[model samples]
Target chain A: MHSLKDRTAIIGVGATPQGKLPGSTQLSLAVDAFKAALDDSGLEKDDIDGLLTFPGTTAPEGPLNYLRVGEALGIDPAFTGSMAMGGGTAGALVQMAAMAVESGHATAVACVFGDAAKTGGSRFNRASGWGDSWGIWGMMGAAANSAVAASRHMALYGTTSEQLAEVAVACRRHASMNPNAVMRDPITIADHQASRFIVEPLHLLDCCLISDGGVCIIVTSAERAKDAKQPRVLISGMGQAYTTRTLEREDWWYVPHQKEALDRAYAMAGLGPQHIDVAQLYDNFTISVLLWLEHAGFCKPGESGPFVEGGRIQLGGELPVNTAGGNLSESYMEGWLHIVEGVRQLRGQGGERQVQGAETCLVTGRGMTLNCSNAMVLTKGEA
Target chain B: MSDHPKPLPEISDETRPFWDGTRNQQLVMQQCARCRHIRYPISRVCPECLEVGHEWVPLSGRGEVYSAIVFHQVYDKAFADDVPYNVSLVQLDEGPRMFSNVVGVPPSQVRVGDRVRVVFDPVTEEVTLPRFTPEDS
Candidate 1:
């Protein structure tokens, strides 16, 4: 029950140019984002005392391990580790950074996620090694796992394809205003329906873009953040939860642990879903956004279909989600950019798609076929 | 199906019995002797009761399709020829779930909650995979 409320603040956020960087390795991209974050925070590389990263890199040629990353960056940190929780690494990184800073383990931490899946080829697309034991076929990709969840939702709650399409349309609309987004063209529900199925119930459009990119966020004690260049975004509250079993778990559609994580986050933040001005919920697939909305208590269990309709999740609507475009339309950095976008929105740096006077932003990360998840609530300087 | 180059499962000490049962045309699961709980994707210990003592119980091989998906994209070159395959989760009658393919019907035609029964395909001399087909098929 120890609270992480306002103990640490994100002083800088940075990313490598989001599309395919043909010549860059994952380590180099990590360095690029780390350097940019340092520059943005007006802190020297020497200021960083801790390092964290995600071990699930799509790049086949580079070492994404934290020790190797530290060797590459020339920073021997006082505290260093890598999280292997897949997409949930982003929120987990922030939570760990806050704990490291708050408990006097480290003064400043640099958390980065980098991948060159587009250029190096996606090693994760194949079914081998660990998947063999579970009897998961090679053809069953991540989309297939999510499609099963979507199919269950449709069967139980009568969630329609049109309702799922709204999520894609709204995200693309938001991406249209974001220069960094890879797919900025405004797509309608018709376009979504017309898109070919990657997995039935999940069109190619419904899936997130595969791009080569890197994003980094710098965290420091709230007191040290006062002297940083940009407006500080406090890591007010955070939570992480995981299921013991993954895809074959009984409650596949509901994602019980994700709800627990969000409830813990909301409780620590002393706020409800109604207080969130914007959300950057992880959208590995369009259906994931709807599931997150429902499980996070933004809407009732079966009401997500109606809750997201009529532009409610758009920029001018009730809760503008994925304001910088999520993994769906924006550049995919394995949910790392979701955290960067949350920080940007809180700092009032979201250029054309900025939610006006946004005070509180909720960011989330989901991984391992929705079985593992983390949620964090961030606010702008004691707002 | 002869030309399909799909990757096969890697059987281990824990999972060998499950695969061995499929070879004999029986669907088996690990049931805890302590709690009478059945589990799939074989594990060393019972998740429910944390008991190392267990038994390999043959199930009725009948269940309902909890959910299904048709994959149109080729994730691996081995599956390039099998572009539109169905992958499904079957909730067994004994309270366990398994990752499998629903065969004997078009992938897109499969629906959630449809009754399914286990069917074995002995692809290689050493391995036999368990798949599902409609109960009445």
Candidate 2:
């Protein structure tokens, strides 16, 4: 009853195809994703009165200003700001959209984000070089950090190389059913084991795909949401939490305060773990799915190997996760495709692998240094 | 995390003791004397008690290999030549994990719960990195 049941609704969701777009510039994809979202809502670029994005992304503050998305479209935003939480930025973007509507600062808030990570490149970093930060190790990307966490998980639970292979195989199976996924071809455990090892305890298949894709959504007051193409997907609760940006903060890469962030979202929504019908978990790496699954209460800590290895997270499982193939099989941009997949499931538009009568979803983002995360709870919306 | 001729960490008044302690080879965990609770990463106040009385205490140098990662990919141009180096977090028995590199072992040999001890690599006249070596060694 405390949720945003009738408070605000996500009227439209839009995205570019999930794959490498060689010819596209970051700005064009950002603009196109926004244009498509508005079109889906039967609104215009002019209808957006607020904007949200990331500073570390390819389409920084300039692209929106250069295109004059506001002035050319005639909408003036009363609220505007950029966000940074590494992979957690997507859920934060959606949460900001809901807050904007709830506060009455803007009637229409468009939480727009898109990156040409595959086309351009991702320029993200961890640690501010504060006392004892490990910037000296010179890890350029997230691979090494995740590999470290994965190695620990393996050491603790006797996790095998084949078990991790199961992660990629399941993701590809789900992707094969999803026409939007990039790596739809089914891979065997042998193939995963044979795949190159980028980092110890982490093979090439265990990492996320680098591709250019953009996803955007428009949120508004429920009263006005009646006119949109889909029912109002009410924004229930949204939250974020960081344990420590530096990996050293946790005994392992596993953080203790993670539950509070998800708890805040669930509390605000008047829902619990059991209420979630599907999970669009952020998978910047395969181990993230394992760690986040346990961290998010789908399983116990250190139990993801048993949880996912059961194939329950795949098709016809109790709670469907990563239905758009996730970052594993889809494009990796803070799990943007997960948001789109959430919308698709709520709309019953998911074709073969659709969760039967799926309405509610829990989306989470993982894969920063440590103790950094974003989470949200969404529903099928009201018609 | 760096070994290049690049900028090194200049110890300020607040954190001078921490860097100095690493060089001299005695394990240190910062604590707020007033609250009797531990603090780490050289903060001004006790994260537990919110008290500003911080002091360093020597430790036993024994800890579990909470986790480790062997970096086969190099991000920095200066040290890209050093691939497959190991970076790990060792949870000191006294509490508080210090970001460090696990050395004296092959990258494939590193594992969680493997006993480790602190070892320092001299940085400059004033600083030495507290790297880790397997306790068995």
Candidate 3:
């Protein structure tokens, strides 16, 4: 694959405070993040010519015009597109931004997603309810789905419930350092075990916290980034994969990968797992982190338990994942905050438990009972 | 037994043997003629090789529980009566993995790599889901 490396860079990244927004509408939050992104890019809205976003997002077309961000933002882009529904759109969209720049189709592109799921029952309430026979057969919620998978992984690999607890514990430790995080109080394995089982093998604490928030990114030609003021993070590698939404997965241990966005992105950028120094993962549930870790080849399949034990994924561990606390401790939306955390790591702006000497970061967006998936690699300043 | 729940999608001329074998209490798999690769979802072509010619094969109904979860919580309020049920992917003796309920068991009895065999439970006249049970069954 012809490398798109250094062809395009994320010049600006922005997000609304992630945790809660009882009064704010979803569109308002998205517009806020869009304006913040424009301000941070030091680019007028008119300079933006291409707009890349999720088709189902709250703001869609209105917010871009509401912010009046295009004037010198070079707003007239040669391309505009939106991803299909879900968090996987975020990282996959970045690759779209790179393709636009590399093909000389557009110089500047924007990607964003925001929602007020807390206002309703959230996407889980939505993804369920299909009235398909799954309901008749007793396959109801994601927690139930994961509890079984988690238990199976444990039963096979000797992955203790305690090891899974460490995943929750380590995330809270990181969240405590991040004021933007929703649940910052550090948790213990005792808490994870003691907590009531929402589904067998998965405690209540193992689930994600829902909140209202917005996230956005500004993509531009890498050449222009040399003259741009803020530090630039190149789009190194990315990948995505999709499976049948309603069908039971063939292997809870091995996710289908032929179309994984991570594979495509990694091949596009020619970088592999070993080069990533920092990672921001979508931990909507504890198993989200574990399975994706094994699926991404960060560890052997079914080994996510030990892969996470002993403070390994903490600030000083082998690979620092979900340093912003993740949906497990942070906000749950499209997992856009994972991108924001990646940007922070690249800019050396992540405070407290920041991954020291972090130059390259990887972020994976997850969704819907292991359905939607994607990954992106961001490298510090012109790598 | 009391009236069982409505069954999943029924096999037609295209999917006949798939649903029928389960009704007769037999385990079956499909192999692509062009590439001889096995596949589920009962499509005309092999997902791996895209070869259209294929045949149905039967097996000992033996396989390992590659991965699974039992739901104490009902996925839907409609399934509330069926609480604490198991849903899982069983990697069959053939290469393809099949999605079915692991029955004749409880939470304690289920584990990955456990030995299991197929059994049929009539959900309706037209449909019978292939469930797994312990080897002793």
Candidate 4:
């Protein structure tokens, strides 16, 4: 398998203030985050020769497309493209950027993702027209789709609502420490249980926050990263896989593609789950993290319920999963924040939630209904 | 009753047969004539053999509930009155899976591995939805 290990580095990360930005458009939020990322990297707009973005409101059709974003940032890039792998695009973006730079296509790449879901309303709600004829019209929301997977997990593995609630509580606890977190008020397992059910087996608390926010990261060759303003984090490994059948498979709850992606990523990084100092697994829904934990080999299948019990995923615990609050409690940048948090931890910039001597961190992105998945391993680069 | 305000599927040349079969109260899938593979959502070419020749074959419509969920939140006002309806992924004994609502039983009672059979629900005059109910029902 081809490897991009240590060939590229993430030198900067940025985010717009998270949560209900009443009047902000996705483009404004994206531009704000993009400028900040450039500043954080100590690179001018001219230095960025590549651009990467996600589809939908931010795609080329929308105002935040690569051409528009480049125009706003005064950049003429050698490579510009959009990836539409849903939430998994962020991790995939880093890999794309690394490959582009490694092959001399471009030197610097900026990957940005943002949305104004709260202020602009959810495009997902209106854009699901195709689902109508597909027989999933009324049942295609992320929460509803994931609920099916969660319900199956409960029936097959005896995973309980209580175990799922633990994920929400742990993410909330981490969010309370991060100033930019949207749902900062700490929540308890009791609180999670008390929350109303959106879909059976998935309480309202188990769902991720749909807020208005943007996140961006700057990727460049390791040599160019030497002069970066902040501590550089090497993009040591990355991999992506997709389940073509999606929820149509008989064993939909078991996400085989996630394991495949993780295995390839681990092989590329030359490390295993045991060597990961911290984890920023995607938590679009609480059950997502549970599935990821098991599939990523943190624990045996059917044992994640017990493994995550008693705050084991909290900041000071065994793995410290989602130390920057994750999509559940932190701002939901559609998995973009997970990569940022991973970079922060590797850079030793995680202030209050910093893991003592964190070196290598694992970050993952689980896209629409568990169809697309991507994983990346990042480590602190030599200063 | 008012129609479901949720967005409906736009019937196209590729998807027309599938929708037409549902309207006739039958579950149909595109079976690749070349590779003999069954496909869903009605595609133009066979994913397996990349062959365009296919036949719309009626399925048994008998399957087990692979997974299920009850929607408590009203994502659209069309579904407001139907708060707390169960949606399930039925893995057809014929080998293709479909997303449909499971009725004829309490939403909370639906469980994985429950035997189910497809039933058609005529919503709009032009659209008939394929739903599922407990096999025993």
Candidate 5:
């Protein structure tokens, strides 16, 4: 099999203001983000030859597809498609763009995401189709689905809520350094504990915000990236894996398959956890960070709680995670912002939250009943 | 003529037998004919052996709480009065996990690893929901 390492690079990234911007439509936000990325890359709108879109859950009646995005942008791409793998879509979309670029199907690809979920009345409190059968018993919401795993993790590993709070605290601390973060207020473990329980083992602060936002990432061949604006951030390695079965699987909550995905990425990169200078682990919930930490081999299984305690995951710690605040405190672009943060960290553009002299970064994404998992290893390119 | 404001399960061709068994006061699951693998959320094909043949076998109705949570926030108004109710994932002895409430006890009292047995709650003339209660109760 041919390796995708360093063949393509991320030339630009852009994000819109997060949190309840009531009047803006998803298409408008998407176009705004695209324009920003275009300017950042010093690439004309005509330069884009591939388009990929991931619609937000709130736009059920009229979701953004590639055709709509192409029509709105006034350009036809040689390669394009919309994706729906939940949070996992962002990383996988970038991977698909890289493949398209490497395979000579397209020169420059744009992966975009836009959502008006917050203002569009997406409370994210409804039960999924699987949860519907048990809805009569009050089984509902993404919180409840994740709470089951959080509860089981606690019972099995003796992981306490305080340890879980460490994740929220670390992310919020990072967000305090970010001007664009939606929730920038620094919070403590006490604040996490005091917050009302959305579900047992998950506090209100433990959950990511339901925000209105958009993010766009531009990918091009390494040769083309060198000619474009901004420092090149190479896609060194990528991997994706998923499980069809859910609660019936014996190791359901543990989700060992995620580790398999990360392992493939590590092998492709010729690096391991020790080589990662910084990380952008997905954090739709606090427990997700713990799972990623363990699955990514940063710490042993069941030890993520202790690993995150005492500011280990905060900036200036041994391993700074989600330095751009993450989905926990950053605007929830699902997992898109995580990738953007990884790109910025590699570009030395993280500003106050920058991990000084950072070279290699790992970005992870998981979604859809906690089944789909993807990992990407990105590295700063030589000038 | 019932007035249950809560959302009810939508019985489809895939899940009809499971509901039919529950209405008749029995807990059943689709067991693969070739591999004898018990599946949940009833499907036509068995994931384990790829065998299309299956049997709606009766379950033991005895299981342990694999995990449980209490909802402090009501997602629906129908559940407003039931705020802080417990929802648990029960791992049946027959090796299938499912979502159901553990009744006959305070929501706070439920714990992981608690042994439970199935109990039927007939919500409407056509539907019966299976719940769990502590073995000791």
Candidate 6:
């Protein structure tokens, strides 16, 4: 048996009301969400013996670290650390928490994330210099990186702007059904096209919201999960892959590593794309979802543009993606919310946006110059 | 001294020679002595063969636009006047890619697969930013 398959389960998932919550510090939001997860799991604060965090990129004070967040939460965890893989951190942290519990390092591990990019006056604009000479050319922000990839996808595969619009429209339509979603007013393909371009091939609508939010998921052994308040969402499979080289590589934009990650995850779960009832793909940009759809083996390479058309990926479609509106519509917790939404869907708690009879879900994340990618397979606990 | 408002590349010991090549109106990169692999954004060890010994070799200064994106919003005030400017990735002839602007045309005119050649802009006394122009331009 795969070491990670069904060894640990997510007992609780909590997300504070997302969007411009003024005066909410990262630490405070993290604590609030942590407490909420504790309440949701019917577990006391004393039950958490491990804490894992993914530091936010745009904290008002400083990027979140485990020591500061752990101290504020008043938990002296036996296993505690933070991972920085950009959007990949949340899924990776959950996997870390699962491994920690499966190895008996801790009874329960809480992976928490909080960001104040919206309230803290972050525009998500900064130059990236990983020993590269990109800043001099005015390449700034995460959007530009993905925009270049979108442009390449369009060039290599004949992907059209209208096809990209379908992603924005679907996410907006799903967001309209989610009351907690920040941008709930429905938008159309025309709206996406009419919106001003942040980067060519990507519009304002295609990019994700910059909002303040916090999310927490508590992981414990499958034995403990059986006694939890909420139904258990088992972590069946987890895989992560990364690109070592960026601009120098010939196929940097193609992101071939993402498929490798998902393949590993699927192999561990003994499942494939045909089994995923819902997906909470990281939507840092609409193109990201398209890439993930292809990478996760839903369709062939360059077929994502067409696969997303005709409402195939929206709620009630063949594979419902971003059931909680994703980062595009749901408040951007930097892929942390994807895990929350995946857990919620598997738990059958997606009040309005539930995928009917959802038994399995695929949650994916990619970040940091579009190099790191991760995928997780979550399934409903046996009845 | 140049009064360039935009962020400039930080020169390091590993990248000094490449910048020096740019200052001399040439596009040069480290070619691994053992593997003959040319590397960009300058590295001490060759990524392919882990070769420490290398020679700075001049490139053909020709390539095609692999991909490009035009920035419509001014994320930084330094680039405020350059809104809608293009930041393109050019795949050079010798098999290295670079982040450079395809100049001598409208940002919208830059397209993938467009043939381009390098041009040096002496942004400062110490730095010369390498940009590209359509070969036929």
What's the lDDT for all of these models?
0.84, 0.73, 0.71, 0.84, 0.89, 0.88
Per-residue accuracy of model 2 over B7-41 as CA lDDT, tens digit each? 35667888777777777897776788887766666
In candidate 6, which residue ranges exceed 4 Å CA deviation? A58-64, B1-4
Show pairs that collide, candidate 1.
none
Tens-place lDDT digits, model 1, residues A1-383: 67888888999889999887899777778889998899999988899999998755653433448877888899999998887777888888888988999999999999987888788777456341253543345445677777878988988899999999999999999999999899988999999999999888899888998888888999999999986789889888888888757544689556789888999899889988989999999999988899899888899997898889999999999999998889898987878999999999999999999999999999999887566799999999953
For each model in turn, which proportion of the native inter-chain contacts is also found? 0.62, 0.53, 0.35, 0.68, 0.84, 0.82
- Candidate 1, position B133, lDDT: 95
User: What are the clashing pairs of model 6?
Assistant: none
- lDDT score, candidate 3, position A95: 72
Candidate 6 chain A: worst-modelled 10 consecutive residues by lDDT: A55-64
- Give the number of the best model, judged by DockQ: 6
lDDT of 6 by residue, A36-103 (tens): 88899999999999999877865443444788889888899999988888788898899889989988
Docking class of 4: medium
- Tens-place lDDT per residue, model 2, A250-296, is 64366545676788778777788888998888787788778777767
TM-score of each: 0.95, 0.89, 0.84, 0.94, 0.97, 0.97
Tell me the spans in candidate 4 whose CA falls farther than 4 Å from its real position.
Answer: A55-60, A126-137, B3-25
Cα error of candidate 6 at position A2, Å? 5.3
Question: What tens digits encode model 3's per-residue C-alpha lDDT throughout B50-108?
Answer: 78888888877888886667665543454556656677667777666665678888855
The number of clashing residue pairs in each candidate reads 0, 8, 33, 0, 0, 0
CAPRI class of candidate 3: acceptable
Ranked by lDDT, top first? 5, 6, 1, 4, 2, 3
How does candidate 5 score on lDDT?
Answer: 0.89
Evaluated against the true structure, the overall lDDT of model 1 is 0.84
Q: Write the per-residue lDDT of candidate 4 for residues A135-193, one digit (tens) a residue.
A: 34467577876787788888888999999999999999999989889988998888988
Q: Ten-residue segment with the worst summed lDDT in candidate 1 chain A?
A: A126-135
Candidate 4 TM-score, C-alpha based: 0.94
> Model 2 in CAPRI terms: which quality?
acceptable
Winner by TM-score between candidate 6 and candidate 2: 6
Q: What's the CA error at residue B117 for candidate 4, in Å?
A: 2.0
